[model samples]
Target: MDFQNSLAFAKELDANDPLARYRDEFLYPQVNGKDVIYFTGNSLGLQPKRTKKYVDDVMKDWHELAVEGHFYAEKPWWDYHERLATDLAKVVGAKEKEISVMNTLTVNLHLLMVSFYRPEGKRIKILCEEKAFPSDQYMLQSQARFHGLDPNEVLVEVKKRKGEHFWRTEDILDKINEVGEELALVLMGGVNYYNGQVLDMKTITKAGKEVGAFVGWDLAHGVGNIALELHDWDVDFAAWCSYKYMNSGPGNASGIYVHEHYLGKKDIPRFEGWWGTKKETRFLMQPEFDPIETADAWQLSNPPILSIAPYLASLELFDEVGMEALIDKQKRIVAYLEFILGEIDKQVESTFEIITPKDRGCQLSVFLHGEGRSLFDYLMKNGVITDWREPNVIRLAPAPFYCSYTDMYNFGQILKEGILNK
Candidate 1:
């Protein structure tokens, strides 16, 4: 498809877009009395307009039913989280029984490690990418310290080659082989947060398993952004936050996926909780812990319905337009954004070096050569909401559900002016 930098071309594309109408479903913040071109959806998604009703229903249930809301409310606060399982499973490409909502991202990762990170004498090292998300880095370091090992000795990093922006699949596989018998776990972010590179999880997971290591993914950015089949990929366990592309809210609840192989097993080595036990026997006050026959066994407490409400609201949009359709629009829209960036770069004296590789999802992290924080400030003041990393990189994520092609074109215009004025 030939790309153009004009507004008419952008409008033509938007006119034909099947997902265009869904943009009205979200509420955006205004700058100078106009809606800002939101590019931070990868960090925190815009709240769905329907979210208020979901939250209100839960609040109303609590007000009317009080203690009876647990089992007698309209949606039943006891099983409210179960409403998210089926649709959430469809978004991440897992069986309904293999997915559960709980806690937060880092918290769930810590709990999952209890079951998957059993390091024997010879197999104690963990493999992760260099400069992972700060939360993940801290989590891995603390986990190793908890097990009485030097983090520097127990955590092996797969570093990118000098001057390169992304990791090669071969390098990661080679690192897994180098760590060999010492590799107890292979856990890394599925989509790199810094450069927006989507790592080849299937190949890496296969390599980790071949070396007798338990493989898992921190799908914080990968969950709703890219195609994932944790069950088919034979992933042992995985977890993600709902605030990003999933569009729940700020620091909302998280989702987890555990393989069916570990379900219904008494010796799976997980922390026990009343909510994780079988529902029928939960109120019976039994002495023994009978784990649920699904991924819910990993849950440690009853889900917070207020947090899950917005998530379930977002999943309704996912159900209306499936991931397949979302991915289709994502590819075309991101391609158009790239074209706009190239066109703008040609017009301006400054260089825009896009570090994000072709394997990216919605985000395009660009190194703004000859630009500074003032340019980012100018963009924000002019109603372009983007994320600025340290140095001069800006991440522009035009999420498919709400972002439009005209936003990309208009951003190109605003960006060119910002560079020229500087």
Candidate 2:
């Protein structure tokens, strides 16, 4: 595709986007005086205008009701966590009872591991992608050491074939089949932080269960940007943060999922706290911890109501625009980005390569042929904002809710200047 040819095409696409009006909802960053092309929604989403009001409501409740807010406010603070479940369940395509709004991503992962990683004799192994976020790797290592197992022996890291930035679906499935008997848990990120590849969660979940292995997903980058069916897919457990595509502020509350099939079995050993106890019998001063028959059993402490308010605001917008419509819009934006990138690749004859899958979701990872870090800094010196990974990869994500096709074109133009100017 020709560069000018593709740029013209993109201008038209932006003009006709039905979701274009949605851009008015976010707080775009300003550099000097212009709206810089902010495409790093994978790392941190732009804040929604509704978030301020959502947070103010909580502040008002606390100011007026104090402790009584737990019982007396319009939406009782005691029941605040419950208010988020239905919307959380719908976003992940799971039953309401299976989903619960709770702690941060790494915290929930460790909690889930405590229950699911009961290593018996030869069954004590954790399988994960090598390129997983460092926090996840640390959690796995620490969990294995807590059980007195060598991290090297109990943890298996799946690597991609040579010269590949992303893992192959077939390789991942075949590895599970090959080691099905000894694997205890499959923990991985939904969309890799580096390459922006969207893994096939349903297929992997099925393959893991075939071998009796517990499967879990960390959806920090996947939650709001992609469509999932955790219930129908029979995902054993999953956790995600709302700060990325969910448009919640930094360090906002996260969510968890537990298959309904596991509920009602209160005897199932899990690390629990008073917050997870049955609400009806919770304040009876009972010594025993009786968990509610849902994902709520995983909570170890009372939720931060102030933090959760932002998610409620974002989820309502998500409900307004269903996942199908969102995903369709995302595909179009990503395709437009890929088209522009392809045009750049043609002029330079593959001097820059896109590492993420071409047909994938809302993000792309670009690699410079000459000097990656220098080019990265040059782009940053300009009005473009993208994330750079170690050893030469820069990630750009144009979220559907607010990013414009004009932004994608601007990002490409900035990239060209960075390359040619260098």
User: lDDT score, residue 102, model 1?
Assistant: 97
Q: Estimate each model's TM-score.
A: 0.99, 0.96
- The whole-model lDDT of each prediction reads 0.95, 0.85
Worst 10 residues of 1 by lDDT: 73-82
lDDT for each residue of candidate 2 in 1-422, tens digit (9 for 90 to 100) = 23343556667777888888888888888876877788888888888888899889899999999999989987788879888888888889999999888888898888888778888878888889976899999999999999999999998878989998788888989888878789999989888888888899999899988999999999998888888999999998999988999988898888999898888577776888988988999889699888888888888788899999998898888888888888998987787788877777676533777889853678888886666688888877777888888788788898899888888787777777777777
Best by lDDT: 1
Highest TM-score: give the candidate number: 1
Residue pair clashes in candidate 1: none
- Candidate 2 runs further than 4 Å off: 1-8, 348-350
Residue ranges of candidate 1 with Cα displaced over 4 Å: none
